[model samples]
Target: MASLGQMAAQSDMVQGLNAGLRRVPPWVLYLAGAGWAGWLFYLAATGGLGVEPIEALEHRYGELALQLIVVGLAVTPLRRHLGVNLMPFRRAIGVLTFFFVLAHFLVWAILDVQTLSAVWADILERPYVTIGMGGFLLLLPLAVTSNNWSVRKLGGAAWRRVHKLVYPAAVLGAVHYVWLAKGFQIEPLVYLGLILVLLALRSRPKATRLAR
Candidate 1:
């Protein structure tokens, strides 16, 4: 699917979006992420959630987390391939992704399951939960190291090496999504395939074209 970017490039939307984005302070992106979660909560509080609200909440959280993860993964590609700069928001993107993942886990463990024991039991018995938890754990260190302090402490190269854990973490996230879906759903598989392609793109070596 073509992103809004592609559509906007061919229309007036790009200018409007860029103008709106410029008017917002850099820090406000954090608030936007928080506001999104708040809106979801508001919906739930007001009984706006559908028949299977718990599932809906879980799906939304996990999906947003994955989408944000993919966003982080796309930053490099956008810069390298399209010359679009998203570097400024990458850290916030990562942090918010982890927040959503944590929220999803909490929703499952508290609101849905309603017990620590059951949470533990589900973690042990459910493959999807196990994989999802593993991915979340992998993201923990990256989130912790995202700040300038950790970058200085670990050295830039070493920090980058450690952060490479995100590749596996993203892969595991997709696998968890696929396993959790009922029957043979194409959506999760599509996400997995897209992740694979993005990772492959990242792995390729850059080359310069020779003069004719």
Candidate 2:
């Protein structure tokens, strides 16, 4: 039947993709992600962002950070459930996400706030800002311990325990976006839903393990 043939074709396509991704150098992914970010910054510098460039720039960084964070979280599930191995690139993705978060914060602090007193005040007065800063703080430790040197220094168990902060950081990051919006926006809701699904997928296997 046509449905059976279509399923076969799709399987072949997915197999081809998995093979190609496995062959590609891990550094290429980091280079491409960082390069695109640099391109966005270049555009912002050149007035190509249209109208409110600073706000556009901040959104660009923040969105990329959230996306990369989700992607990093999805790697294990993708490999285990979908048989698409992304283990090699997971570290690069996490580091890139942290840098994107840092860029998002700096853009808001420097271009948007422009004053130390106001920055502190906004952090205290604005609930979204407060939650955003909390998310950043959670990521800070994971970012610092991402390197091989730190891994050896901290030992595997300790390192993994610290890295577990990614879960709460991701939740807070999504919540910050939802609260940041002026009204009930669909985009933020979609992101929040996606993260919740990913978290649920991640937890199910653990719950099964704990029961045994």
Candidate 3:
């Protein structure tokens, strides 16, 4: 197996993507996030963000969030199996995952439902919404403690325990997507399979026993 850096270098997809992404300063990622939120707002104000828009937005956001979660899960495996250097970007990717999940929930609550009462009812009555909310809830603590101080305060073991919620989060997220679609579909199934495999890889004895 190739090292993480070697893996990154070998793939045109990764290389091209990282080449453009590397040019972005840390502040630019922040700005990009703000820009995404602003654009969503603009689309809503212009009546471009309605049911179909919300569906599209949430679909994309959910996909991105899943990818980030998977990437975070892959870090240890990549480093161990491939001898990759993935530590530096792990936190950033995790943070971005949280950000996208937040946006996904916001778009659903604000743009799709447009009322707290409606959102509340959906959470109560809708299985998809409930599962989605559960996934979001799982992400909350991880997002809040992404910083070094929190890690130090919580200790690595405790923090790792909290972060393990990502596994359930991913499972819930896939179920949410499948329920939302109302039927079996290729895309959601593919993601579901990928997430399961990634999770299984992380759950192996060697991976499981490795200390953070």
Candidate 4:
């Protein structure tokens, strides 16, 4: 069996290969995220980020969050199945997922409604918004407790349990997407199916046991 350092080194090699294939540095990813935020601000300033803009922006944000969730979940499986350690990227992806979800909520609240009371009412009365809000709430604790101190405070078992909320959050997120579409759509359904498969793969005894 490989030592821990050997395993980590091998994993780093895998990550390097993967990153090289994409030909984009980690800093470039951060730059892209910043560019996205800048573009949104520019649109808002130009009176373009309103109802239709809100719809497009919210959909993109929600989809990005979902993709990040999928990527985070994939890390474990990639490690187990390929001996390619990706644990380091998990935290970054998870945090970005939370950030995207925040953007989704903020766009809805600030751009779509522009009134706290109206946003509150929609969150309470609209099923789609309610579901989305619930997912965001679930993400909140995970985001807050993602740091080293919080993990140390919670301990491994407790911290793992708290992070497990991601499962339900993913489900709620998919439902929110479906509900927001207001009709059956192939793309969202595909994402829902992919999420379900990822969850199922992650839940298998081999996967769960290996994760430990």
Please report, in order, the local distance difference test score of every candidate based on alpha carbons: 0.85, 0.91, 0.79, 0.81
User: Which candidate should be chosen as best, given TM-score against the real structure?
Assistant: 2
What ranking emerges by TM-score with the best candidate at the front? Answer: 2, 1, 4, 3
Give the clash total for candidate 2.
0
TM accuracy, model 1: 0.85
Encode model 2's per-residue lDDT on 1-212: one tens digit a residue: 56988978877876887888889888998898889889999999899898788999999999999999889989988877877778889899999999999999999999989999999999999999999999999999999998999999999999999998999999999999999898779998888888889889988999889999
Q: Which of candidates 1 and 3 is the stronger one according to lDDT? A: 1
lDDT head-to-head 1 vs 2, winner: 2
Candidate 3 lDDT score at position 212: 42
Q: Stretches of candidate 4 above 4 Å error? A: 1-32, 43-51, 206-212
Could you give candidate 3's per-residue lDDT for residues 1-212 as a string of tens digits?
77998766667555565566556565555567667766866775577767567776766677777777777778777766655546667777778888989988887788778999999999999888899899999989989999999999999999999988888988898778777775557887777787888878867866657854
The backbone clash count of each candidate, in order, is: 0, 0, 1, 0
What local lDDT does model 3 show for residue 17? Answer: 56
In candidate 2, where is summed lDDT lowest over 10 consecutive residues? 79-88
Model 2 lDDT, full chain set: 0.91
What digit string (tens of lDDT, one per residue) describes model 4 on residues 1-212? 99999988988888787666446444555567667866875785576767566677866777888888878877787777775555655767788889889988888798779999999999999988899899999999999998999999999999999999999999899878877775568987877887888788777966767999
Clashing pairs in 2: none
Per-model TM-score, in order, reads: 0.85, 0.92, 0.77, 0.79
- Candidate 4: C-alpha lDDT: 0.81
Candidate with best lDDT:
2
Q: What is the lDDT of residue 208 in candidate 3?
A: 57
